[model samples]
Target chain A: MSAKPYNLTYPQLGNYDIPIGFLVRKGLGLAYTSPPPMTKQTIELGAKHSPDYVCAPFKCMMGCYIEAMEKGANVIIQTGGTCRLGYYGELHEQILKDLGYDFKIMNLTLAQYGGIMGILGGIKKYAPKRKWSQIAKVIPTVAKMIKSIDKVEDYMRKNMGFEDIPGSFEKIYKHFLSKLRQAETTKDVEELYHLTMRSFSRLPVHKPDDPVRVGIIGEYFTIMDPFSNHEIEKKIAMMGAEVHRWMDLSHSVLSCPDDNALDMLRSYAKYDLKRFPSSIWVDSQRKKIKKYVSEDMGASSVATIAMADHYAASGFDGLVHVKSFGCTPEMDAIPVLHNISADYKIPILYLSYDTQSSDTGIETRAEAFYDMISMRKEARQS
Target chain B: MKKAYLGIDIGSISTKGVIIDEEHNILASVYLWTEGNPLGASKKVIQELASQIDLDEWTVVAAGTTGSARKLVGAMCNASIVKNEITAHAVGTTTLHPDVRTILEIGGQDSKIICVEDGVAVDYAMNTLCAAGTGSFLTSQARRLGVDVEEFGKIALGSKNPTPIAARCTVFAESDLVHKIQMGHKKEDIIAGLCNAVANNYLNNIGKGKKILPPIVFQGGVSKNEGVVRAFADSLGEEIIVDENGHLMGCYGAAILAHGSGIEKPFSFDVADMEFVTREVICENCPNHCEIICVYRDGELIDSWGNRCERGVIRS
Candidate 1:
């Protein structure tokens, strides 16, 4: 309508941007640009324009959107979430427009959209040149790419500390990420995943039997984005502990529901892509971890609490709870986390992030935590 | 030759050094103001400690460093073990008071509460993004009160009724203090109120939800203030143990860690005379602009850190 081609972009969240970019370029047949990796300047730029009391993730995404716009992105897509994130789209659009930037926003959670079909229609309206058949063809490949990245990262978090050669795991991980960006087919992704996995296994490691295990759980965004949380998972792992994190695109979106439910959704979508039943999710995950979290506390609270309890029950030596400052959903999960810590007699290190650039305080707390847990483990063994 | 371990704690306000024998008995110790020069302060500390100990009778084997500038001082001293202040405080307090159930420490720029179980730190927390309830706050308040910091405790004890002051933030507390002074509140009462404000702030912030049991050991620079000690005792309704050597605990813990590390690196008092300089370089290669620190000893680059990536690393 504006006589300009659609160049789509989304805020960066770890390397998941790769899959998102792939979907936009290959599925929607639209021009896409991934924002440059987050830097201190980006956060500062974001914080400068954002409201002072908003959580850090909002500032981070605001920064990302501005950066993407600078790279010629004309259409920005913001997905719906169960938190303040649901309202961020309109706010971001308003602020950017006020700043005199001209761009179209595809906000999925805009109440006027009639649900899943309405969401699909919005996408179709924006990507009028592409057929539904062509878009459907890329969905499976996108799913596979996300699962592969999550799998590789999961393994890397658990084994990076013990690599016989320092930086061996990181080196392979970097290579895999580059190869993943070039993948044009599902087979290419599968090959790269397997190759990276094999290289990881082949790398010699000096891990002791029953090494200290630490689980990371908290707000969805800050926990997954390394820069947001100061690469805390890697920091803890490098301190001679195996780190476990379960919040990612793979776990949260792709593989959450059972296969049967997924198949049912697929059949409904195939019936002319007219329906997407939210009830099919059915809170099965909640029923499974009802002891720890009965009612949904909103956003990622249920997932955070359930995973914390699971990690504690499974004999994790420690837990690290990372959240952005003033994150209501994660803040609500603290009392529950305390109970879990008491029940399992495990220590939990609580880290809250703001826009401050210095990490000296974080480093001190992390080091002290590691020392306490390792000492506790040794005392138990003796 | 008798073997001894040396530990140094270079904090923002003060520098502390201690030399201990195999049995954990202190051979010599020194405490001095840091004066915004950790290297210079630590050098003076080392010289004073060396003068107190007979060099011929005891040979220092392992050295350790802790506190804010642990790494900088550790590199200078060739310390075999470098540890954070929390761990050092826990180990030192637990070693001294084996039954210490909780350790409440208020330092120059930060405060922390460590919950101990069976002489081991089970859980701990430090002040985040705030310095309202720490030693520097009290010193600044002391200057405003026109009283010596050393005499603050005695003056506070003389108050029959302590004034209630805001303790949520340093900025807020400063304005509140000025307001109270304008309202003609007794000086002793105001000072006592400031002490109470600190204790309450610490309890609500750093010690929130922490199980503070009996046999609590209060340490750090603030522990020297009887006003704060009294405030804490009144609030927790428990006996707070303040050791004479509490200020030296961090260094003492470092010494113990070095001794237990079982790696002996010979130490000499002569290192104190060598030139130590630290240079901060801001990496311009990336937007992160990480501040890389380079430590030099006698004009030779010995250690460098604070770089977050390969691009920021300076090839000395």
Candidate 2:
């Protein structure tokens, strides 16, 4: 007989838990597991086996899927999107199958057929033991869990740096995650969410009589994925400065397209006087969709520039722009960034990430840059 | 007043410096191993250059820095201009050879091909991803063959019939060299084969799909290897120019850039006496803990970086 219960695994994206939770409550799985975090080794392994010169994210996901297989995940779930990521599930499945791995790939994304019913059917195939009635009973709980996690994270990000004490957010965030993991009922999940939000709200923040604030701008995946960008926010915060980042998923989905365009315009205006210049164009529609669907997908040049302007106006210290290697949008955005860096006299540190094992060289470079900016700030103050 | 400019190029494997007079003629030049400590290496380079020149005849009006550690070394020396190797090399080469159409630089760690027209670089490609065609490759192969790297060129020149070795990647090249050696290939022939392999690898990787024209000046640490220079000449079917000051091109370019920057204030050599140290702090911004580095001089931070964001600016 097949295993009585199983956990479902999916590659990470913006707020993936909500969808995973939704599927699990519908009686398909016991726990929703995110693939292991992407790392240098992950990228290296992925690139070694993957087709040469594909986008970096493709290699990253390939690595994540291969790693998950190694972890004894029997069934894999993949979400379909407009970008090439939508088709990645099929390719990943085929590659893994050729390697003689025994697993089922549940692809929710269908190029020809797409709807709520379609996704439900896909989940049902993997979760054969769960009755449809039982599956129906769990959806609300999963939705609540997702909402709770996203809300708490959003609140923490905006206020974490301003906390009166160091490690306060971290302390509460750990408790929050543990509670989230153990949450059995919708009410329990809701209660945990409220507590986390409260802790976030209560974080002691003094309006810096003269705060050095910085905006972090970059590609969505690298910007949001701490591993990819090298924990730039923490470094910036440790510098006794406030930090701002505007590339969250909630902002992308809830906000209208016009708002995104307007935001882009506001940021671009700083460097170029012309409004809404279409700088980069990819021939691949799937690539474009991948960028559009994710809030900070591709190179988040506009968001970074806008946030940098905001931080600069707010008397922030500097800006940091991070991108994966060979991100074209960022390459196009750099000239404008140079102009903004000069115009505001705000130092901007640009970091490009690849799958190299060594972090020593990167650390040395960062140390020197921080010292230079800090010295400048001190010089001005004295 | 005879004005002079100082340019320093601190790379991963070597440190180079050049002192240039008002006319951009090298007054003093020095090259040494970076020895894993850029600050110390730079200080030594500065002292060596100082000892070689008359301080009264030339006052350093500005200082420039270029290379991977340019920023750190630039900060240490109060550089008027800190540019990337590409810009620095282009400027330096264009100044020395006004009609140069291409600049090929294969250094210890990296290789670059610059397409120049009208004394300005139009396009360029740099190979930081591979180690097959760089000076490090030759150094490793020299170690394997029990030959000193300094004698690599002379040994290659002695080869009458160089063996044909695979030149695609380092692993394949090593295997091919081993196979050829087992087949009773002469040491000189193997050395020549290795030189040719490096040239072929560079042409296939960095020089692919580019218009490589003559008036080509080869520069960088690897340019000192006459075997590789000869290999390049044979591969391209053209005579390659290797200047006596080729290895100093990066520093020369930086110095030229510094002079033309229009910064009139004289540079002081007081940096040699200052004590600088690098400190690292873990940035707990998110799950990816980035170790931000900060450089301090006499207990005061001069610069910090290594963060993906502007988060590690905490100064006491």
Candidate 3:
């Protein structure tokens, strides 16, 4: 078969810079595009054309796919999932084909065929020029780059508030990403990692004696997307508090399964709450984190309560809970959060976001919440 | 001195505000139509709340804002805590009915289903995109029928043999209603069918994929309609409870959040007197032209956000 040059497009979640950057470094794909940001036009188009009563995210993705196809994207790379999203790829492909868009779709998530060879085979279908050995050579380097990116983000989450100058971590983080994209070897990756970590460590900073720390608890998609929650964590952190967010794709898919069994055992022993049966391992880990960690485990109900309890126990003075407009897991957690708020006597802020593109309203509320918590803290001290 | 807490809830249709004591007792509450101006309506609600409470006797210490406009009103009131309507409503309703398992909230523009497990919201869904299930759709239909919106429930309840109206989208429902009237169907029967349509629309849309258990609380503006309430009760085969203060749940939750915040500071009614304006500008950076909004407080730029890029950081 003749080699056909293709560009891949993935669904937009958080910042696509790192993922896009990773793809570029490997030279597997010529170019990539993140789905267009959800806007009024996007929603209107999606709702008008999509099947009535489908989940909002489905319509959103469909809208993005249609727009991307119009923008001259030839090949789309979709991941498989356990949820309804997994089935969406096939339907989307069919719809796009019906619309007469000539393109190739690379679905990474095939059923239960778990192995690196499968993934390699899938990619090779589009890029037949690259040998398996050549692709294998880039894996370790790509893994190192991912590690470096996660480490920088982890450090920034904890110490970003303490920086003497605002935007210091952000500046260094940008440079770190640039360096990671340019690195061709493990040694280069290691050098850049150390330099980024050193800059993060040495950045001018002062730790507050008792800052108003808050943990962000929410659904996976809304929590990761800054636009959805109006960049709430950053807003709360800007109020001079260390913000902790434990939910991410890396944590949920990569780390949570191993920690789940241990967490379940801890929960059964401590809380005697045998409620979580969805995933025994996840429940147990949630329990252990709730009991042992200073912050919440970032599950559905447990995430909110843990955040509330930690804020109060740590004397952080406040908590902020955010979710998509209609997320199910969070709806179940709100009442328990009420009792925790009452018992701990720490203020909690709740925000539900839809597709509205206005941030003026969000900023105003965050500012007011900060002012209230700060004044309350000052009053208690006085 | 007795300390007071302020709570504000801004929804698509209305803005509500409430002042409560440390014991969670409501001192003053105000509800008014939003009129497409959340900023103005919130200011009015706060001013009215301030007028009811003695500024000297009770010091407004901690404040909270919730609902759709929580962020905007929270900023206007300088709230200590700003939360979502789910948390706010769950907190507010649970305080009144500790065993509430389900919360059905239908407002002018949207509807939501919040599932509570052990006094906490665990699962929830909201319908903002579809108009068929919300109160605004009902109100517009009531106007077309030349029936008073307030009497919708009574008329619905009076029906003996309800006529079937095509109740899917607002357009289809309107045409169906017109057809039913031309066929000489009784007004009360048509009204009853409209109520059923509302309930059916909600169940299929917002209530989809939810295992709705009861000790359910029906809230928001539409809860006032007895016919719609009966339809929900009939459809679910469970009794629906509508609190007298259900419309104020968002504000009530905000008050409770503020009171529990443990802040002690005096509030100034000067918030109502302050001038705030929002200006929207499009970002020219890259292909995505993001419209950024800048909020100015008394000629000083308090905050600016909207552009995905740093191009629109500076304002002229």
How high is each candidate's TM-score? Answer: 0.95, 0.59, 0.63
Q: Give candidate 3 misplaced runs (Cα > 4 Å).
A: A1-136, A143-173, A190-382, B116-122, B165-179, B208-214, B283-290, B302-316
Q: Each prediction's DockQ?
A: 0.72, 0.05, 0.06
Candidate 3 chain B lDDT trough over 10 residues, lowest sum: B121-130
RMSD to truth, every model: 2.8, 11.5, 9.4
Model 3: lDDT to the true structure: 0.71
Q: lDDT per model, in order?
A: 0.89, 0.71, 0.71
Which wins on DockQ, candidate 1 or candidate 2? Answer: 1
| Per-residue error (Å), model 3, residue A287 | 24
Better of 1 and 3 by TM-score: 1
Better of 1 and 3 by lDDT: 1
lDDT of 2 by residue, A1-382 (tens): 1553565676655445445645664456566556666655677767876767556666777777777667756677765443345566788788778878777777766442355566667667666677888887876776666656666765555566677787888789879876776677788888888888877777787646665556777766677666555566665565455566766554432322233676445433342211111122111212333422233233355555555555666666667777777767676666666566556666666677766645544443444345445445655677
Instruction: Give candidate 2 regions above 4 Å deviation.
Output: A1-10, A13-59, A62-76, A79-105, A109-120, A123-354, A357-382, B262-266
Best by TM-score: 1
lDDT of 2: 0.71
lDDT of 1 by residue, A53-101 (tens): 9999999988988999998998988875777877888888889898888
